[model samples]
Target chain A: MEHTWDFAAILANWRVLWVGLQGTLIVFAATVTLGLGGGLLVGVCRYAKTPLLRLPSMAFVEVFRNTPVLVQIIWFYYAFPILTGIEVNPFLAAVLGISLNTMAFSAEIYRAGIQSIEPGQWEAGRALGMAYQQTLRRIILPVAIKRILPALTNRGIEVFKMSTLASVVAYVETLNQAKLIADLNFNPIESYTAVALIFFAVLYPAVQGTYILERMLRKSE
Target chain B: MEWNFWAVMTDFDLLLLGLVNTLKVTALALLFGVPLGLCLAVLRLSGARLVSAAAAFIIEFFRTTPPLVQLFWFFFALPILIDVRMTPFIASIVTFSIQSSAFFAEIFRGGIQSIDQGQWEGGKAIGMTYAQSMRRIVLPQAVKRMIPAFMERSIELLKTTTLVSTVAYTDLMFQANDLAQKTFRPLEVYTVVALMYFALIFALSQLSIAVEHRLAKSGDSTVR
Candidate 1:
């Protein structure tokens, strides 16, 4: 049996997918900001000498990192409201899950980057009468963040891909919209294929750029 | 807001079965993905331009797309395209096996490329064929160096298997949803299921870390 390929359904439903793209972009922007920004703070806590700061952050990273993000999303949607009497819409739940997971994963990345800096740099900051926080903010993080640019960029890409998971909660992301198109038009093949191609088009260049960025970093180092 | 454990306990057996199914999928996906990845790695490194380009396309396509999308495509779209009956179990396995294989291919490529050019030359000098050298010399060394990365990807694959639930598979996450609806105790059911995943994945993560440390201590240069 030969199956005929038809993209007319997808072409007609461009507006539906456009809305999904907006949703994806919104969630991706929100999560990437919260995830990476919060990650730096948690990463510093994980690196701190104080046990109070270090232990809890370690536990936070491990719990979020070890569990699957889908599970986290579902838990927030269905379980969290029961626990805290707070209503979580699908978007908020998805954002919380992906961002927290990214935080845990990127915290380790940031910590590793911070650890890679030399002790002499810290001493130099201290020699200039800088406090611990000031030295870290001024001396260490600039270099560390530059060193881990490729890694953080990769995390951002992962977050963009993860935005599709929001659809599991019926959040109107690209995959969810594709599902909608497939159902309404009875064109699963075209709908799903179009979604996959859309992601590849957006991400392939970014992935290639990462390869270039990594090579450039290696060269500079 | 009151907590209740007894309600969740009644359906505990179902969740256990779901956990078993989850592990079964993960184990099956790994069983298939590793060798497929090696084949992809070999093909991607082939001297023929078309063959290598085709392999690279496959890898990048799978890696860039979300696994959920791939799962949906396989479960929903593939049957219509291929005119075959598709089960959730089969779709989950096929999608994950292929998806993880793409990632594993990169790992294999890295491990193989990390080996010195001299290793290949040394094998050639000894009158060995390419396949002969690869099977006997390169793969054995490369496989060992690939262990840490292999294990890390496996851990990732396990976590990713959760997507199977979206297809109505009886994985732990699916079972939790079922149990929650049945018992009206979403909090207890989800928390417990999340903990179950945490325990299983955390143990594997620790085991991989241990293996990595041992490999590092034994003076073997491991590739990521």
Candidate 2:
């Protein structure tokens, strides 16, 4: 089959693409916020001595990290309503799904970071007369966060990319919006290529930025 | 909601079928992917600049892009580029193999590079050709170094197989979607599916730990 490439059609719908971009950004922002918070809690919980908290947190991380995000998104979108009798919008469902998935990965990253701190740091904190909470909040978290910033940034990029999966559940993110346009126009290549470019535009910079930030952090150290 | 053992059990058959398909895809992908990865790794490590650059480009392109996009491109976009049709399963296998190969290449390269330069010199001094040295001595040691990374990559590939459903391939996640839509019990069905995945990955991780421990014990005396 011979076909002419139509740059005009894609450019004509640039507004729609922008709207889709907004949706993608929203999901990325929401997932990062919720994921960081949830991941920190889960990470700290894993280090907790209490079996009640640690066991469940361990199970949560295992389940989320093992399964695919598509399954998790569908499960949350469909199962959440049935189990709770409250219907969640597709966007919210996508946010929650990505957040939970990112939490699992971030939890592991945090654990690795926290474990990397020298035992002497803890001893020194105690020597300085800081309480456990104070040491964790003021000293330990700062050091651990600095050490893990590179990994966390990498995880953030991952979360940004995985947000594309949200399109599967009918969330009008960039990819889903592209799919809709493709279906309507029967031009899958143009639509998806546009979406791919948009995603690259967003993601590539974040990844590059992370590397730069990591180098800067190392230099300051 | 009330517990429905019979209903859940009846659906168990379909779930099992899905599990089989999941394993089939995972196994087939790995079968093709690992060797392709090793080849790419070797090529990348080749003393020739052109070969290394080409291999590096292939690895970087796949590694940086999202797998779902790669899947869509292979399944949908590539057919448009080339005048040929491929089945979803075929497309999935090809795409995943290519993607996994990139990861495997990096892992293998790291393993191979970690070996001391003295080892290579030692093999060459014994009158072994480069290929012979790599095959008989270097590769075996590299494989030992690579086992942990290999296990981790396998788990990653297995988890990534869930993305196959995006192209309308019927794997465990697809079955879970279908069952959830039919039974309207997304939470329970997905919970079960997630649990199965967790069980498999957890087992693989345990197996990896055991292998690493065994290798460490045997290789302790050889440490420099």
Best candidate (score: lDDT) = 1
Give the count of colliding residue pairs in each prediction.
0, 0
Point out where model 1 deviates above 4 Å.
none
Provide the lowest-lDDT 10-residue window in model 1 chain A: A1-10
Tens-place lDDT per residue, model 2, B1-224, is 65454554679888888888889999999999999999999999999999999998777667666778778877877777678777889889998999999999999998888888988999999999999989988888888878878988898898889999878788888887788778866677887887777788788878877877887778721222
Q: Which candidate should be chosen as best, given DockQ against the real structure?
A: 1
Instruction: Report the Cα lDDT for residue A49, model 2.
Output: 79
lDDT digits (tens) for residues A11-130 of candidate 1: 999999999989999999999999999999999999999999999999999999999999999999999998999989999999999999999999999999999999999999999999
* lDDT (Cα, 0-100) at A38 in candidate 2: 90
How far out, in Å, is residue B139 in model 2?
2.6
True contacts kept of each: 0.85, 0.43
Interface root-mean-square deviation (Å) of every model: 0.8, 2.0
- Over A97-188, each residue of candidate 2 has an lDDT whose tens digit, in order, gives 88998999999988887878888887888999998778777878898999899999888887877888888888887777777777777777
By summed lDDT, the worst window of 10 consecutive residues in model 2 chain B runs over B215-224
